[model samples]
Target: MGERSDGDVVLAACDLVVAGIDGPGVSALAGVSLRRPWDEIQPLLGDALLELGLDHHEHNSNEGKALGLRLMARRTLAGELSARELAAWVHDRFGHGLPAAEELARLDDEYDILEYDDRATTDVDEQVMAEVRRITS
Candidate 1:
């Protein structure tokens, strides 16, 4: 739970490179632009959105469509690609196409409750997990 290094994150700009996307702090980053500051890579991120076929209006592109958003949702939730840092960026660019930072925070909060609630199963948490799976799937 220490602070991650710059290469620890699988950023939107680094979507082309899948080395460290398995989780937070998972990738050495090999050869990617993640080492650069976010401002320098913002344009690359915009290209990623376009490459995925996602627009400012829609979540999925026509090529694979559902797959990219699903990857984004699941990887973020798993702490791989990450969402917290890019929430504002994603919102400012993609709008409803991707989850905003607030939604990501809500999901994280619900996930934390699921981990420690001591219930056999909370219906709400199950629903949230289901949503996570649905989006990821």
Candidate 2:
């Protein structure tokens, strides 16, 4: 793969965070309440970036890109994009050839299951649930 844009790296990092939270088995966000604090989540983001081969030395040296990624993550956590939307973004950017795209597809399935379970118990907004259903179904 060519060099990923800063924005692409940040979005991938966001995907990693969501996947870590919602993937099967135990997770840090598993028993948490509705509001997930960034402090608790930021480390996971850093780990995700590292796993994707982002160099810590480069990240530390490039303060601007690092700050941009942080802002992007904040926006992601703030619900600027829904799970489906994020998946689509990754799909469009990376296509099916990349490992990250495949992993994102798997994560999309996990997201669907979690959303289904959440919708079963709580009164999740109909529009949001419907969109998720439409995308996942």
Candidate 2 residue lDDT tens string, 1-137: 12354444445444555776333212333332234443344344454445556544333244433333334334444678654555555455444544424544445445457655644422323333343444343
Each prediction's whole-model lDDT (CA): 0.43, 0.43
Error of 2 at 32 (Å): 48
Q: Roughly what TM-score does model 2 have, to 2 decimal places?
A: 0.26
Q: TM-score for all predictions? A: 0.29, 0.26
Error of 2 at 127 (Å): 19
| Candidate maximizing TM-score | 1
In order, what is each prediction's RMSD in angstroms?
10.6, 16.8
